[model samples]
Target: MPSLGSFVLTCIIIAISLVLSVSASVGNIKSGPSPRRFMSGSQRHNATFSLTQIRNTKWEPREMSTTAVYAAEFLKHKVQMPKVLRLAWEKLKLHDDQSSNSSIHRRVDGQLVRYSDGQYVFPVTIGTPKQTLNLIFDTASGDFWVWSWLMPMDMLQNRKYYNGSASSDATPWDGQSWGATYAVGSNYGIVWQDIVWIDAIGVAGNPIECSQGVSNWFASLPGVDGVLGLSYAYNDSEKPEPQQTWITYILPLLAAPVFTVSLVHNGIGTIDFGFIDQKKYTGSIVYTPITIIPGGGAFWAFNWTGFAIGSDKYNRTNIQVMTDTGGNISMMPESIANRYYKLVAGSYKQANGAWIFPCKASLPNFVFGVGSSRIVVAGKNFILTNLPDGINCIGGIQSREEDTYVFLSIPFMQSIFVVHDYGKMRMGFANRTWV
Candidate 1:
């Protein structure tokens, strides 16, 4: 048997290759959830969509379970989304000790959704009263911050909501007094108060207590009230580190040698605690040094090799790829997409809703390049070949989309065993069974 260390190292190598070797292509239509089991070779599924009317959507507070323990099973199977990228859990241990890490859980539509929103919410929290918060967890960014959405409005009058606003147990970023600020994104607009204070963030039930640098941006979305930022660094670098981010405060506290995440298909993934899972990995952990995007805080990134339509490679080069939980679709270059459609003898078509195409009975494989490496990956279905012209170009396809197709949403994360410990500053991956 391999030594424990050797076994873990081997697993990391396999995990990295598995992720990087996924082929880029489109596939045939299907009508079901994504496959929850892993396969030796690439597979593809077609994606379809229909807009659902938002009806009877209302908010009700679900009591946080008093029990701390929960049952967990190993995960398997995988799916992909084209235009939407498969996202990984952006993690930061606030205090560093094993016990300091909070189980990250998500409240989807209020119930213990177990899984966080794929691209909608962050499993993080902020404030002195320990106000629970979530964010668009972006691996490319490193700043830890929060926003206010669907706040009771009356809570604003409670004064406790503004713990950082009053500078009571709270501190300010760069001596700046608490005040309201505004910003915008691809989605909604935001207006918030900038404040600083300790944050108690939780994931899957694990909690971490630490100081944070945050924004009080507020919106009107229920179930999702605020963002939980996880950028490499904050917008203001001069601010004290604690006042800057929770990740920064936790990086130095880890006892583990490295970390990793498996954004598998289905709601069946795990974040390794002390080390990578040896049973699921194959070789040494592949380490690639990455340069953060100009505005990205410290999200890790790598280069993509090529994409293909069916067996023929699209032949585009120099594409960049990053695993992002903030993005909901697999995205890529439009030129590459055009080439893919041409190969399949399929043309992009505009639908009554989101434009779609005639998904061939045969699925085309898509590959993503990472730092001169390429990995073969599958798609939810063949129907949604690529994004519409105005939509973002995605070589980065999400696995699950419609019923039969696998979505690259948080559910896919359950497919792979993962860990992202800050202390090690390294990522690990493992192949787990969805069964």
Candidate 2:
């Protein structure tokens, strides 16, 4: 008979294999909620009319839930038990030797919702009385900004704006003028410091950019109030003195120096601060070193080994992979994009610079390697649905000519659980339970 430890290890290996097999089989089946419906006639009309007309229209708050589902797959499968047991034993020995030095860590979690525009927004409260606002939890950019009272009335149309005067906790951060430009639009604003709350935890004197004016693209998205940046401090675009990201200020308060995100398609996922929820993922979490950009850590990027589609594998000499929740589709090098689309029948590049194909065209599972681990994104996640008329659908993987970095956007992120480790300067990925 095998030793108890050996038997346990064998069982764990079998369980992990079964879980992976089941996940691979389920990839063929369509799951999760359908894509969001197109904008209403009234919304479309508002888009065409003047900003004043849209501001006059009363905007009712849509029912968006931020409750996350607890995944039971990990408990049922007993995946990663061997590693868990080893870690628990080590911790137990430490506790027995020095109980006073050991400290209990507290984890804070917030619910995240996938907006119609494919961005993940989480609930944030600012001010003394605590006014809750749905802000985009973006890791790509490092600027915490919100729609404020200073903005033009036309710009405030149908969106909630933070009124600093109404909150006793609000304090002006000098007369600082701040401006930031994203792929969407440019926004210039005044800076303010106030009590900001994420779930039950609150951060005092949190820096917030209150926008006074914005570009046309910013005006179009009336649903999103502002952005809560989670990137490093160096990525912050604030002029003169750079401000640290919310994660930086809140790290001391957390039990762990880590944050994890689980983004599911059309369903409520979660952002856990200071700890990783083993329940949300299966198997072991693969950790990859964070690649530093030229100037600084602009985004959570890592060195990508290569990408594989079915039997064909493409190796790259130098590749930087960055994950962004703010973006909808993945962007790769032009050559890679062309090669990927060629694999699908009837897929061709459009004059408008988009790769289009038959809506029903079958695509191979997109797999990318990081370190020694492979992360697989299902084919269903690669099809961008609800395009403008005539264009059936476009490939989710688009081509970018400028940057050497390949962007893994929300479409790819929705398939896995991502961990952003600040202390270790590493990013981790695991197979999501649902996928």
Candidate 3:
């Protein structure tokens, strides 16, 4: 009917219109308030079976270009919190035999510690009441230490502070012979030179041989006596490299491409290296752009959505939000919460405890303001069902401790994949289905 050129032009116009239409449809679907878009109720309860059936062992491992200009630009700096020393003076040391690969030794488990109000506390067995003391365990740095100074005068006179004075039940180190360094930072970093043979070794999971014992000064938390460095690469010669534990202990046995750390309340935690749990992975994996801090390693981060006290979507509310792997509960400003309570569908107490009454007619879903999008999380995901009414009334609103902060704690990580592919500066999220 029509000339060849005219017919071709007509086809092109039709194709363009189709593309535009399809794109618009997709954008609308993603942008729309598609409640429970990823799954139905029955599906959510049974999602774990789907997750277990997934074989994460299969991987066509391709090394990505870790160096990218765009990635560098997307990097966010690590949060530097003000920490002070709790115990007066504690000194600990580490050593390298020069023969074993750093990776193999990184898998050991030290004491699990908890942080609160800028202080750290953990039980230490030093063979006797006089020799033993409480210490702080830190993962941000490397270097094992104990308070060597400011000892109880009675304990000082009766026991040993690893000062080559008394031998209790433990094996003594011989650091007196080898060359060591005594380094201290203005922030209570300490290091001392000595050739000490470590009698017992501890770390995260596996313990290893102890050939030499060296100590160094470390910037520590306030009110915390000891610091346990879970960081990598103390020799300073290793770069563009993961710490020994990250490489040898964790990466070697991982069944999946990613791992998550879930630190539950009271220091009970689990580290899932390969996949997401079925219970938490009911929704689509949401990805937020993150900036990684180089050299300091990957600081766990996320796109901050606004904090929701209850189920009400706070997309319109402007609130400051932060995530802390170290934080145990959702902490919010009382002023903002007091005002928000009126709009929420719940009641509360005036005194010590906080509780919630979730109505079937309306379950609260709070939406957070991320980089560009609003992330809606239902109360079921944020609050526990076991609480009295399952809500804490801070100020006046029934606020469930929300994990909307940037630091993906163990419980929150159980709900999402917090992927940290170091140095590249980008993180990814896929529903547990994708994990």
Candidate 4:
């Protein structure tokens, strides 16, 4: 009924109106409070997930024409239009996904309760019906594994095992196997896929390895059923076929590619995914670039500039250090460890391989540098516990082979709030506020 040009104009107007309407809807949804559903009964009490805002403001700007005057004007005004549009698009997509109740761009907080053995364990639910298990959230490992029904009955006594048959979403991955050898022990098992839930955030089709057998060291772990590794996906121990880490699969569903760990002594710690709690730490977060270990190890390795014991400062160059939540003691190079102990009078290495000192000895103040920031670990924190006789006390910092890398364990972690930035391959640390 209308001319070609008029009809074309009409279609264009309709298309633009539709796009604007959809965009306005998305903006409204993102600005409003998202609907939350809770699991009825005790399950609801065990897990409480909430979204937190991301603190980092860094953004990547889109490339623009060098000759464009408007581009220069945008830069002069400190407004990156391309980046802003990209962020808006991301928000729109995230809102659509959240509305579908399939995925969410929200920060998730998981409770970490300290165990008697000085290790912290967190809860992770697996499968369709949701079987919850307390797992050691190890930052050094790259595999998400659990003790399974496939193991011997005696070995499974008092230990929870994943019953794959009971999970409707469980899918077997035949021929895929994974094995990991830790300083404590080893575990081996078959790889499978299922829904893995941390707090209330569910990652469907999550790759998980169910351990068929474990060494005595692993079996002896108190109140731990398995490990949920937080290391990069490339470090997965699945031989012949390596799969992505659990975090990798869930990253897309998060608002930010960051996770924060706050460890408290003999108390409940917390792991925040997608955001950092500014209130948990003091001062600005100092970020240090990750040092990739030769041969590609999965540890959260970083550079250590130097260390100080009281007024004495020891400078180092290119020293690579790592943090592991699974380890209880901080292990440093033998020479450095000796030097540190020397600063504390009466501290000596015993025949039992422990470095012990008088329980009442005044320990030297210790601090370590990462980049431009210095993290001070109070000398009192280095004293783990006194002997039963209450004379000699065990030191938190111990000596390892000179070739062995330095490992910052629970003692060091407890004093700082750490951020593991997978997207940037950097580690950020800030002093934790003792409550």
Q: Could you tell me which 10 consecutive residues in candidate 4 have the lowest summed lDDT? A: 15-24
Off by over 4 Å in 3: 1-189, 192-258, 265-267, 274-280, 292-298, 305-322, 329-417, 427-435
Write the number of the candidate with greater lDDT, choosing between 2 and 4: 4
After the best TM-score superposition of candidate 2, give how far the Cα of residue 352 lies from its true spot, in angstroms: 3.4
lDDT of 1 at 51: 14
lDDT tens digits by residue: candidate 2, 1-435? 000110011111111111110100111222221211221221221121100001112222221111100111121122222233334334433443453321110011111212134133455788867786766666766778788888778767667878887898677665354665422225677677777776445666777778777644345555457777778665554555567787776665566778887766544556777677788888889998898765435678888777887568556435888776655556677788887888888887543355667767888778788776777777766665433333356556776554466777766777788988888889998876554
Candidate order by lDDT, decreasing, is 4, 2, 1, 3
Ranking by TM-score: 2, 4, 1, 3
Estimate the overall C-alpha local distance difference test score of candidate 4: 0.57
TM-score for each of the candidates: 0.48, 0.70, 0.35, 0.70
lDDT tens digits by residue: candidate 1, 254-311: 3443444544332223233234556654433444444344433355444444555567
Runs in model 2 with CA error above 4 Å?
1-115, 118-120, 182-185, 314-318
Clash count per candidate: 118, 0, 57, 0
Task: Using lDDT as the measure, name the better of candidate 1 and candidate 3.
Answer: 1
Better of 3 and 4 by TM-score: 4
Q: What is the C-alpha lDDT of each candidate?
A: 0.29, 0.56, 0.27, 0.57
Q: Which sections of candidate 1 miss by over 4 Å?
A: 1-130, 134-136, 147-168, 172-220, 234-244, 266-274, 279-285, 294-297, 307-309, 313-318, 343-355, 358-363, 369-374, 381-435
RMSD of each: 19.3, 22.6, 24.2, 23.6
| 189-291 per-residue lDDT for model 4 (tens digits) | 7766777777556765666777777745356554456767678666566656666677765665566788887766545577787777788899989999888
